[model samples]
Target: MYISAFPTFSFSKLIKRKKAQVFSDYFGYENTRFFYRGAYAIFYGVKALGLKPKDTVLVPAYHCGIEINAILKAGINVKFYDVTHELEVDIESIKSNIDEHTKAVFVIHYYGFPQEMVSLNKLCQTHGLKVIEDCAHGLFSFYKSKSLGAWGDISVFSFQKSLPTADGGAIVFNDRKEDCFITQKKPALLTTLRAYLLLYSEHIHMFKGFLFSVFNTLILKPSRFILKILKRGGSKVITANTNEFDAQYVSLGPSGITEKLIDSIDAHGIVVNRRRNYQHLLEGTKHIKNIKLLFNNLPVGVCPLFFPIRVNQRDLMQQYLSDHGIETFIFGKKLHNLLPKEQCPVAWAYSDELLCLPIHQDMNPGNIEYILKVLEDENCPLN
Candidate 1:
């Protein structure tokens, strides 16, 4: 079976409850503010803080474009900061970009690799800028003993991305005090409907993975119009581009389901399995010439979302892997280009060469060996 970089959920217990009941049991809550998704969490965070329009916010040039939209939706101007070759934000560029108008800095922990938060926090303090850590990709990740989300003045985590939740986001404030904004009572009906639908979708996907892949690759590939419509409707809200910030806030339900799921995952040793698979990939491909592994160690504390490799022939290697049923990803393909050609030169270079390879919980040592062998046979310069 082909491995996916995305996280999976096991919902056998969730499937037993009525969708409405599940929503009420899991989503509705007091003492917590909610939004449609993470982007809205960001939107509300900025609004709740009462940031004025035209205030400048510094963001990594190479990031999910939706982040730009989120900042814009909050009526703030965004400035781009360059990223290092390792994909972390360039500290110097961040320092250079700071000015009186700079009110906040949003940092993305790319691919679950925690950025140098200590330095970033110091930088923010020096400039009197508030920090918003976008933990959409770095949920549950830590920097030293501190959590990534905890470092920022305000932080947001996308439960949809890291957790198995259908759609949810949470905002943590620096002072841990609740501030006033447009708030709402939890939507029990919607929460229940979404949870059950997500649970059902998982089962359907597992049972018909091959069929779905065929339909998506073959049937959906040629139908750009249909795909566009589907894309617009299918949680496009999560992407930074879709701006529906003015929409009403709805509770993502609560932490009961997420806590249970996390407990179950721990009980089943999924984290260990994920780490072991990551280690297998790292060990298997350590000597691949012209391909540099971003980190020297098996990434710990922050579970790697994918095993990323920077290769000279990234596009070719990706095709080579795909042809052999070993899937790969080209994350942030147009990241730097989206900013400006000459603005972030190193980020542009890194974007072209980086390829994220599969290292999910589903893969085994045999799978890792097979992928390595295929690369070796293809004259992929395995040292």
Candidate 2:
């Protein structure tokens, strides 16, 4: 069976869940609000910020297009900024782009590594611009002593990426003074069922391989139709890791089951295991000639979302990994056409060369070692 990028469903967690009364206590954050997906959180958060129509928000060029969609849907104008080839935000580029009309700076913590928040916060403070931390890859991630979600004016999280939940996204207000609320009805039953089935097939070992694929392909279309009839999360079947945004469902909230599923996650175990796997690969791949590690050192307090690498040939390397029963992701290759044609060369290069490796909590040392060997193989010409 092929390994997945994020941890899959574990029935063990569902077997032991907290009651509704303690749901608030589980996350331990008083100002956190849940949504159907990260894009919804972005949409609502931008709205709540009280920006006027066509007010510009600065965004990274190497971004998931769905985020750009959410901002556009919120009636906000977007200005792209360059991020270094190493995936670090270009502070100078950002400073140069800020204008009187720019109301906010959207900072994405690419692959759970927190951006230089102190510097960013200081820069934003001088210009009176609100900072929105896109922590979609950064649940339980910390920058120095402070947490990623707590550093920005508004922060967004995706439990669907970090946990076993079928669907969940959250917006957290860093400043307790800012009060915002969102209420959404539970998704349709068919939508929830389809999500669970997909999770089971992907995450559960017993259900892996061709049979699961056959089942999903056969039932997905019909399930989507039933979902549309039932008015679920959306009319379409929105799978995880989708490249495009589904604007129709931007207003929807999370399923009722997500609340319970999220509580059962072991945050510490996830961090420890993922870090171990990442460090393992980082150390082993240092000598390879054809690729470059995005972040060479795992910093203290940082929880990585994936092992991002820049390969000489992304498509060929991805196929090489897939043939060995390993899966890889081309994170954010689909740039929005709306971005200016001439700007952001570094981000454009990254979109083509960058490949995301699976280093989820589910992977063991053997699994990580196998992945390393594949990349470091002398016989394989990944370049």
Candidate 3:
């Protein structure tokens, strides 16, 4: 009865979903570049902006750190802007931070929620700053009847974040001048193998079965040593953290396997199921006292990645669920160290209080019921 925080690569869905158009083909092969990881995509996109040295890109104060690392690695300065406690981009904070050296504003669609794209575009246009849409959490997210990644000057997406890919990322230049282009190479074999193995190990721990138990006892327990020795994200089936950005990986493109999976995924089914599961949690959690949902409404044209909530005892609640064979993880709990917490206390405090419950494509109504029962039994806020 174990449930995973991350979506599993389901063979069942693979059978139903036929191979379709590839990323490069859909986005146009000429301007799209793939990468081994999302951070590398960020780096490549930042470099493609044709920004000069000493140019500053304004980013949110609350972030997972990798985006800033990628931007800095591209030989650019970064200035942190405030994000309101509600997780919306603060436009005034952005305005206050913009200056002559500010060349771009990197907007993240946090946890599949859309930002104020129209207003942000207007401001960026007036200030002459490029908009880089970081859609790492926003593959299926949409606003105003339009998809998220296409709203900016250029965009980046991470398939591993939304889909059950071994690893993948892509950078799309809305319009790239000839001088701004760079050729990308395929990823190394070791890099491809490591991510797929992690995906396999994640699948092994996802559900309860006699065969999975035997495999865990015989193979995984002994191989657990080797698995740990292999540098990776949370091998416990919830991979929320990512490795820091590397300069060498900037030239590495997505693997063939990742590209294939992207074309094979059930795009419509994934979006529908996830939205349904999210509504179940939303309606079901109302009676659960002392717990607060991050966003009260599931806006139209938006697909949520996770059900985020703020509770007083977030760690304790996370552990309680883990003990029950249900895994949940926090997002952005560890902010980029360079961001001064004192400058934006609301964002920092918001980070510490936040946790994301699973609402991935694979989950069902029964799983939602089980999760709701667990929250009620333990009285989640336990403050």
Candidate 4:
């Protein structure tokens, strides 16, 4: 039984008709605009913030390259800020980078752990730089008593990453002056059709059997491939969130199905189950001498996105886990051209070493134990 990093969808979630629900309270935003992907949310956030062309913004060296693309699409210039091996922002690096043209500072709360927002916010305020929090991983996370997304001038969230939704993204504006709702055209029907197929594939993947794995590898992969060749721009649906940036898809909003799926979610249960799964991984890996857990303690109110670990043989370990029916992720190993690998050694090293294991709400205790046993395999070459 492979444990996926993201949640598997249920047919019940798709067919049931529910009343339209507002998620402002859950996401800590009074208003939000949904998009087809997280990159679009960021794209519009820059526009809403009035960041003009050639206006520089400080961004973390540790990032998904798509964000850099979104900023560039908005015609904004980007400067790099270093992040520590422990995934914390280097405040001094950020301070040194801020200059006359810098209009905003982009902050990413990697793996749903909140950064030192108070310190970072103070520094941004000192230079009068607007803070754009990238809470793509921090949807249900908190820093002290405040939610991760609430602290920024504007925040970007990805429902696809954290929720069981097929495709969705959102932007929350803290400053009402920049708060304007957008009415983006609905995603294409072909896109919506692919979303359903992918969702069902995820549901089928939740079943524990070699037959299921074969079905996923054979049926789902081929179906998606054929969809790519037959439909218009279907390849983007498969590769939407990878390192590559697609300008053509930037203006699109989420499908109606995505909105309905989000409305059906149990927000509190997501946080609880994710936190529990995180602790299971934490406990399982705590005693291992060969690797280091990037984050050891789960703070109160923080919903962990994954269990990040550092090892010399990251690529090998990821393949090993995949072979054993567990999915692992490597976070943002590709550095954008704006921030070369040579300039940010720490972040580059982290990009190479960090492997994110699944801790989503979908996995049961049995699933957790199986993943742990694989991690502790003595025969494994990667120590």
lDDT digits (tens) for residues 60-116 of candidate 3: 988888888999989999999998877888999999999889999999998899999
Candidates 2 and 4: which is better by lDDT?
4
Clash number for each model: 4, 0, 0, 0
For candidate 3, give the lDDT of residue 174: 79
Model 4 residue runs over 4 Å out of place are 14-22, 27-30, 177-183, 208-229, 232-239
lDDT for residue 221 in candidate 2, whole number 0-100: 57
- Per-candidate TM equals 0.75, 0.88, 0.90, 0.91
Write model 2 residue lDDT over 5-38, tens digit each, in one string.
6678867766554343222433355777878888
Give the poorly placed runs of model 2, Cα more than 4 Å off.
Answer: 16-27, 177-182, 205-241
Instruction: List the candidate numbers ranked by lDDT, top first.
Output: 4, 3, 2, 1
Model 4 per-residue lDDT tens digits across residues 1-383: 76787887776765535443436555533567888888889999999998898899899998868898889988999999888877799999998998889999999999999999999899988899999999989987888899888899999898878887778888988777446556577777776777777666766766745467687788878886788687564334443445666777776888887887777776777888998988987887776657688887988988898888888888988898989989887888777877875777988888788889898888888988998788778855455
**Which candidate, 1 or 4, has the higher TM-score?**
4
After TM-score superposition, the amount by which residue 45's alpha carbon in candidate 1 deviates from its true location, in angstroms, is 1.8
RMSD (Cα, Å) for all candidates, in order, is 6.3, 3.6, 3.7, 2.8
Lowest lDDT 10-residue stretch of candidate 1:
22-31
Predicted structure 2, TM vs. truth = 0.88
Better of 1 and 3 by TM-score: 3
Better of 3 and 4 by lDDT: 4
Q: After superposition, how far is residue 309 of candidate 2 from its true place, in Å?
A: 1.0
Cα lDDT of model 1 by residue, 202-286, tens digit: 4345445757656556554555455466557763322212333434443233335553443343312334556677788777776
Q: In model 3, which regions exceed 4 Å deviation?
A: 11-30, 177-183, 221-241, 379-383
